[model samples]
Target: METSDQNAAVDALKDPEAFSVIIDRYRYQLSRYIQRLGAFDSDTTKDLLQESFIKVYLNLNDYKPSLSFSSWIYRITHNEVMMHFRYMRNRAQAFASEDALTLFESIPDELDIAVESDARLRSMHIAKALQRLKPEYREILVLRFFEGKSYDEISDILEMAPGTVATYIARGKMALGKVLQEMNITSV
Candidate 1:
């Protein structure tokens, strides 16, 4: 079977219809990322997705095929989320949506089946820890672990050096551990 063009940006620019393919590929994942990062309402999330896609379309010429297309789209979505965060800066803490919780559960873990019943508790602990983190740390960890992006991909998405991405992940994990410890979430 023939493969689709890997340079989606160029294809999308030349044929506007091709942009929908990018949207179709990224919309759901992008929505999940926005929800996890900012916990925006559905209306707001939809609006952000629209705006982000529009920007992606407009900026197609700027994309470089040397980088992963996934990373480029994620970087756009990440900026949109941060822009919304700035707009809603006065708001209080936003809880994770059910979808976010489901996504977290979908990731494989090393815990034994005996701990299956305790998953809810662990999820809550993690959610709280994530909320306590600074946006930079939280975002880096989310992109790496939740979205399954590599350090190089994250560096592309976040526009940081690879070493900086590693540092943030390490620091984010330490911060998460500290938060969990304070909440008495010690392991057996």
Candidate 2:
């Protein structure tokens, strides 16, 4: 991620393209986070990323300018994502429930690996594996994978104990690996 200097903050809020630079900087990092959670809405994920940057831009005036930009931005993104999930669940009569939406959107992202040759095939394997996971397991995986946050950070975000976070991440990963094995696809 580009260091959020004072000037960059100003530019980002004022110009959409300027915000793109911030996205370009954190795109992979954040996507990895989202992908872990079984989220694969390319546009929505990107929208969340952009929203994080926009919040940063809009709230630059409130920033103390003494904290790490990484933590600040990620904290916002985390909250936003949670709210997004909740919002989609209750609002808009398109889906039966959040579970249904997760069933559809999250699978595609589960297999989004940065690999060479037969990417589509690998993605299929990935998606299949993800579908087998329980939601609790799935959520932890996505938090770690997409956000790249540490155990403590995740604990704080989820308001769970650190040990709980560890258990979830471990269980989720094991479940993912097992799912991959069942599909005869080597886990990435």
Candidate 3:
């Protein structure tokens, strides 16, 4: 059977070398997540990821099996990105064009919108619309849709109640739809 993330955590506590398994498993997902959260540049994303991993390694002793390890790691990564934003004193930026395309592709089904012929232009509009959303809404949308996190997982990561996560997702979708409408990207 494949080792569960919880088991990996337990093993990593015993042998530090086992920690690499956890890092390897989470690196790509978390890196993409960091980018989605607004670390636009590769260097900044890599640095934040390194710092987050280090924090994760240091705090391995605190890993509670009751919470999925994925949630815990994501919580740590999310905090790191937020801290970076606070330190920089800047609002989160728009997704890179490629990421905007990916994000837009996943959104049409949810928004009940038909994929338009000019996907590039639509994607740019979507990216701009996403940037206009409140930070809480945008973060929840990214976690729920872009990162494919469940309500329970998002709750654990954001330290919010599951109901709040659901609420944010609903409101975020509505707000995103409104913004898209303002941009004249109507549903068909």
lDDT of each: 0.74, 0.60, 0.82
Predicted structure 2, TM vs. truth: 0.56
Ranking by lDDT: 3, 1, 2
Worst lDDT window (10 residues) for model 2?
Answer: 90-99
Question: How does candidate 3 fare on TM-score?
Answer: 0.87
- Summarize candidate 2's per-residue lDDT along 71-156 as a digit string, tens digits: 55666666667677687773112222332333323332443433324545545545555556886676667567644567776775
Candidate 1 lDDT, tens digit per residue, 12-47? 877898878788878899987876676566788899
Please give the lDDT score for candidate 1.
0.74
Give per-residue CA lDDT, model 3, range 1-188, as digits (tens): 87889888889889999989889999999988887777367788899999999999899889898898899999999998989989988757756677666545556355455535687877667667767888799789888877888899999999999998998999898888787777777663
In model 1, where do residues sit more than 4 Å from their true spots? 1-7, 90-92, 106-117
Better of 2 and 3 by TM-score: 3
In model 1, how large is the Cα lDDT of residue 37? 74
